[model samples]
Target: MPEITYRDAVIRGIAQEMARDNDVVFLGEDVAKAGGVFKATVGLYEQFGPLRVRDTPISEQAILGAAMGAAMTGLKPIAEIMFSDFFAVCFDYIANEFPKSRYMSNGQTKCPLVVRTGNGAGSRFGAQHSQSVENWCMMIPGLKVVAPSSPVDVIGLLAAAVRDPDPVIFLEHKSLYATKGEVPDGEIVDRLGTAKIVRPGRDATILALALMVPRAVEAAERLKAEHGIDCEVIDVRSLVPLDTQTILASVAKTHRLFTVEENPRLCGWGAEIVSIVADEAFYDLDGPPVRITTPHIPLPAADILEDMVLPTAERIVETVRRSLQS
Candidate 1:
């Protein structure tokens, strides 16, 4: 095992995938020489040469359109969109084109493309640069959305996304890029739609995704220490095609559920999960499932206001407590 940053794990995953399959190509803004906005693709151009690792124009539409074309033409393309906020520019290509192309062609052609982007608020990049756009992508029919919380999961899920036959959106939290964690040696591929129960407990279940997983785990530990409450933490790594069975099973055992998400409460990912729980495991609930999410407003540039807007460990604990009370 080796301790590496989430960014390094992503870089290693891309490099390994490129080495394994020559069909895999990397393209995005400043990805070739500058190694991407976050340097996630650093040294890739030097290793794979220009044709495989290309630096594209400053248009996400162009980048995504080119990747979709390459994918349709028998090549696996990994397109980077700098920030998740910019994905709005290419929603037509993604929602209408990339995801529907293969099915529209009667499964004759597969769009094996991975669109990687950075998301979340905490870098003080303001509202434009920081937004959790995963929920928006999850709304589409033919897209598989994955958000990894730690370095190990980041590497594993990225590799899985690259190898997936359908169009996959791999979202990396900007705040977790520098976070270090132990990643196992050799290749690892995490199965899509599989929820991981990071901490097992008999009391209550907390469903979290991406960076929220770590926060939930911290809050679980704090609850156990302070109030003697055992909270089970389940990481829903993949948003679309969510592992509803696993979540329901956990809720059945714990008899209570609380979801933590960085997105806003209105039309947030938590809403979907809560709906699923209500529909499937309504009888298993000991109390109403509570949701912890950001305020329904643009992320502020100031650190203090940003902290107030986003979900935190303390908020997660409070949500769990409220769930128990209700």
Candidate 2:
């Protein structure tokens, strides 16, 4: 049980998948020679060779379209959109082409493609490079969106995404790339749509995704120390096929709910989580569900403005406190 950085774990998962299946190939800008913008695919090019690990052009559309074509013809293409914001450039191919091809063609074709991208706001990446757009993909019908918060989860979930039949949007928070955590030595595949309860408690349930999980956990620890609140933290690892049952059950026991996400408040993943809670666990909730998220503005370039926009641990704690009070 060796501890490794989240970036390393993801690289290991991709390397292992490539070794296991010759059909599994990685395509993205800088993926071949530079080992990816974040080095998540380091050493992959040398190990798998140029044919399997390719560096594509700057166009996100071309990258996605090539992935779709490769997937439809039998290869499992893992295409990387350097940043989550750039994913918008490939929306047509992702939402309509890859996700709908199988159904549109009467089940004659299957697009088992995994679109990997970096998300979240940090490191002064400015507004354009640091947007969390997973919610947009989650809105699509056939696309499966996943955001892993830890090294262990990232390794396991990426492997699962690669193996799945449907097109998967695998979002890794750029800020968490260097964060270290325990990851199993061998290949590990986390089941899709499963919500992991990181911390068990009876006072309230705090659901978080991606980097927000760590923030929620920190808030939970502070709540226990300051307000004597026992908060259960649920990592809704997979966003699209959300694990509503686990969330509802946690809310049932805790009687209070709150969600933390990096995206903006309106029409974001937090809204979707709140909607699910309202539908399935409305009566079970002792108070209104709260969402700690960014404001409905573009991610700012200034550090001070950026800090104010993104959800913080303090915000999560305050939201939990408010939920408890209500």
Please report, in order, the local distance difference test score of every candidate based on alpha carbons: 0.90, 0.89
TM-score each candidate: 0.98, 0.98
Across 1-326, the per-residue lDDT of candidate 1 in tens digits comes to: 67999999889999989999999999999999998889788899999999999998898999999999899889999999999999989888878998887788888877899999999999998999999998888988899999999898888888889999989999999999999999988888778888899999889999898888899999999989987889999999998778888998999999988889899778888898899889988999888888888888988999988988888999988878766765
TM-score of 2: 0.98
lDDT of 2 by residue, 60-154 (tens): 99999999989989999999999989977778987789778888889899999899999989867787999999888988888899999999998
Displacement of residue 265 (Cα, Å) in model 1 is: 1.5
lDDT of model 2 at residue 9? Answer: 82
* TM-score computed on alpha carbons, candidate 1: 0.98
